[model samples]
Each structure stands twice: as C-alpha cells, then as structure tokens.
Target: MKKNIYLDFAYFIILASTFGAVLVLGAVVAPVVFHTDVITVNLLIDPYNAGIIMGEIFHRFSYWIYFVAIYVIAYEAMAYKMGQRDAIGFASAFVVVCTSLLFSAIYVPKILSMQALGVEATQSDTFENIHIASEIDFKILALALIVLFIRRLLILRVPSK
Candidate 1:
C-alpha cells in the first residue's frame, strides 16, 4: 500500500474494529454485564442448567467480535506504516474472529439445553467466565496492536534533509 494508503488501511482496520467492538458493547456484552434477569447454578457446572445464561452470553458475542476488530484494523494501519504484512498482523485479527465464531458454535445449543434442566451455574461463576473471556479477547487485541505499532516504528525511514 502507498504511504498514505497505509494510513487509510490503518484507519480502516482500527475503525472497523472500534465500530464492531462498540456495537458489541451496545448490543450484548455491556447489557449482560448489567442484566437483571438471573439464574442459579449447581455443582460441576453442568451443561443443562448452564445453558440459558450461556445462550444470552452466546447471543452477546455478535457485539464482542469487535474486540478483535479494533486490533486487526489498527495493525492494518501499522502495516502500512512499516511497509510490511507479516503473519503476526494477520493472525492477530484471525484468532479473535475465529475464536468468537468457535465459541458461538458450541455455546448456542449448550445454552438452550439449560432451559430443560431447570438450573444453572451460580451467577458468580457465570459472570466470572464472562469477565475472563472478555478480558482475554481484548488483551489479545491490544497485544496485536502493540506488535504492529512497534514493528512500524522500527522499520520506518527517517527522511534526511
């Protein structure tokens, strides 16, 4: 990409991630953090009871996918800055989206099953998992961004007068 296009690409990547991440917050992740509807859980974190809460959590991922969105987008900008596109740049974005999709696939049916079970995990555990996953994904995004930024700074040319 051209020098300025690099800037455009960076904007594209970060903005996309932010747009997606913020939407996720609006649509699901943030709302659930504050949700009033509650449930109870039992020993062993049984799938049956855990399903409904899981369902809501799963549903919320649409918004959360943006967690990675921001990182990837920012890296695109950095990639342009450095004049390079390496595996790290691509993998960072890829992992977040792929993991989100993977979690959704498993979480959907599991959540539904909880309805029939008449019980659920303790709210503590449920919330804990949510918090942990949210942080982990966001951290991954941050790390990716840092790597790209550092790489850009390292490789960029200093124009001589």
Candidate 2:
C-alpha cells in the first residue's frame, strides 16, 4: 500500500504542534501570567485580575483546542478506515479527542462563567476544584498528544530494504 507522505506529515506536524502548545501554556505561560511578581514590579495586579487575564487566554485557546479535536477525529477515523489501526494509537487519539473537548467545552466555559460572577465566586471551593481538574486534564491532553505523535511516527515510517 502506498502512503500519502504529505497527509502523514501534516498529521505529525499538527500533533507535535498541539503538544508543544499545551506544554508552553501550562509550563511557561500559566506560571508567568499567574505570578504577577515576575512582571508586575510597578503595577499592582490583584489575584482576581490575574485570574481574569488567564481566563481570557484560555478562552481564546479554546478555539484552537476545538480545531485540534475535530482534526484528530477526522484523521484517526480516516486512518482506521484505511486499516491502519492499533490499540495504543486508537487509545491515545481517543484520549486526545475527549480531553480536548473537555477542556474547551466544559472546563474553560465553567471557569469563565465563574470568573464572570465575581472575585468571590472565583475564590470559592467550587472554582478551585474546577481549576485543579482543568489543570490535570490539560496535562493528560499533553501526554496523550505526545504519545499519539510518537506512535504515529513509528507506524508511518518507511521500512528500509
């Protein structure tokens, strides 16, 4: 069977890029945004304001997550139809789709709504729990993307004669 190099390459690129984005947002972006001390030497940004800023960032990112979820579903479904199926790859793709949708659809929207309520709402135990759960889900999404990327790479690599 002949493999379409372009499509396969695009898939890998998208998977890798998604993983990198998740890592950067969680590791690099979140800490810097939340830690006003890092960049707010002159201005005083309160916790609530910082939370609002972070919420905006995540809200914008939700669009990208939605796209990635749909793309992953289409790509994986096509691959499956082509008989290129495996347990690990299927599981990883499934994780990616579910986590992506969960983060964009459930977590981000809930967080935004809570933020909209007021500082008091954000400070509540419910907000804290949801925030923590979202963080964990983001981490899981990152892991799944990397796993799927690596597995797809291996599966699609051309054999040497």
Candidate 3:
C-alpha cells in the first residue's frame, strides 16, 4: 500500500508536469517564437526562420513526449494489473498514449522533413494540411492529458471512513 501511494504520487506529478509543459509550449512559447515582432522594438524574425526555430523546439519536446507516453503506459498497465481499473481512465490513458506517440513519432518527423526541404515546401498546400492536422492532434493531446489527469486524481482519491 505504501508503495502504491508513492507510485500514485509520482504518476500525478509526472502527468501534471507534462500537462503544464504542453500548455506552456502551445500557448506561450509558440506565440513568442512565431511572432517575435510582438515583443521586439526593432527586430523581426522572418517566418521561415521562425518555422525553423519552432521546428527545433518541437523536436526537443518530442523526446519528452516519448518519455511521458512510456510512463503513462507503464503506470496504467500496472494499475490495471492491480485491479484498479476504470473504463474512462483507461480510455483517456489510451488517448494520451496514442496522441503522444502520433505527435512525437509521426507528425514531428514529417514536419521536420518538410522543413528540411526548405521554406517553399513548408509554404505549400501539403505542408499546410499536415500542419493543420498536427495542430488538431496537439489540441486533442492536451485534452486527453487533462482528462487523464483529472480521472487519475479522482480514482486515487481516498474517501473519509
């Protein structure tokens, strides 16, 4: 029981931190990176350069996402083996894992490859569609993380006896 308690705490902390990172990157870092003119008085980063910068940011973040996905899967599997299963919790965890993998493995690599092809490729319709899809995937990923966090919190809550 003590071990379970510690594991639960660790799981919550990891989930919360990952959730916060997702929010901060999407809401804060992306905006600042893409729109340097918003904060600069005399400097303006070109859109191509901004895309490169953002690509690098996501590239680094992809590793974190991979780690989080593995942790989430391992934790959820352990919980299930311990017979502490909830359908919604499992579903949310699945979404979290799938989206995390999709973003880190598929989308990030594709985006980087298109970026390597240069600005013209990124500006094309194909890149635009992929970028839009990635944005939607990211939003879904965020939602899944929050849902998993709340569900796990509720599941881990111990009622007063």
Candidate 4:
C-alpha cells in the first residue's frame, strides 16, 4: 500500500510538471512571443533574429521536456513492474514520452538548424512545412499529457482491492 502511494505521488509530480511546462510553452509563452506586439520593435528590425531568439528559448525549454519524458517513461515502467495494469495510463504516458523524444531529438534540432540558416531559409517551403509539422506534434503532445494526467487521477480515485 505504501509503495502504491509513493508511486502515485511520483506519477502525479511527473504528470503535473509535464503538463504545466507544455501549457506554459504552447498556451502562454509562444503566443506572447509571436502574436503580441510585445516584441514589435525586434520583429520589425530583423525577423530572422527574432526567430533565432525564440528558437533558442524553446531549445532551452526542451531540456526540461526531455527530463519530463524520461521521468514519465521510468515511472510507467516501474508501475508496470509493480503490477499496476492500467493500460490506458501507461499507453498515454508512453505516447507523451515518445512524442517528447521525437520533438526534442528530431524536430527541434531540425528547426534550429534551419533557423541557423537565417530568414531566407526559414521562409522557404520546407521550413514552413516543418514548422507546421512541429506545431501539430506539439499540440498532440500537449493533449497526450493532459490525457495521461487525467487517467492517472482517475486511477488514484479507485479503491484498491
């Protein structure tokens, strides 16, 4: 019983951290940086520089995401070993981890490399496509994290036999 409670606590912490980070980055930080006139002067001066700046910010943020991914994977694996057979929760968390790894290891690095090529390259069709794909992936990851968090909460509410 104590082990289960500890596992639940760890899972909750991991889920909350993952969810909060994604929400802040997707819902708050990116919108504020891209949509608002908060950085109008910088954008007007050199849009490429602005993009590079944002890319750097996101790159730094990805480090935290990588940690979250590892934590989710480790926790889920531990739960499975302990005989917790919540398949939905495990699968959702696994999706989150995989998506995070894909984004951080593959997409983000590609985007950063493109950003390094300056505004012209970033304006090209390939860059645009990749950017769109990254956006879609990010949305998927965010949704997965939410699902995992909710699923874990539901599992916690159930009485143990």
Give Cα distance to truth, residue 151, candidate 4, Å: 0.9
Compared with the true structure, all predictions reach lDDT values of 0.49, 0.91, 0.89, 0.80
Candidate 4 wrongly placed segments (more than 4 Å): 1-4, 36-46
lDDT of 2 at 148: 97
Candidate 3 residue runs with Cα over 4 Å from true position: 1-3, 158-161
Candidate 2 is scored at a TM of 0.95
Model 4 lDDT per residue over 1-161, tens place: 34667767877887787778777877877766665456555445255666776788879978988988888888788767766669899788878988898889888899999988877889999999988888888888888988998987886687658
- On lDDT, the candidate that comes out on top is 2
Model 1 Cα lDDT, one tens digit per residue, 23-115: 565466545444434432342434433344545654665455544445555655566466565566456446545555544444333434434
What TM-score do all the candidates reach, one by one? 0.39, 0.95, 0.94, 0.87
Best-matching candidate per TM-score: 2
Residue 46 of model 4: what lDDT?
Answer: 51
- Per-residue error (Å), model 2, residue 53: 0.9
Error (Å) of candidate 3 at residue 4 is: 1.5
Candidate that beats the other on TM-score, 3 or 4, i.e. the better one:
3
Give the alpha carbon lDDT tens digit for every residue of 59-91 in model 3.
999999999999999999998887778899999
What value of lDDT does candidate 1 attain over all alpha carbons? 0.49
Cα-based lDDT at residue 150, candidate 1: 49
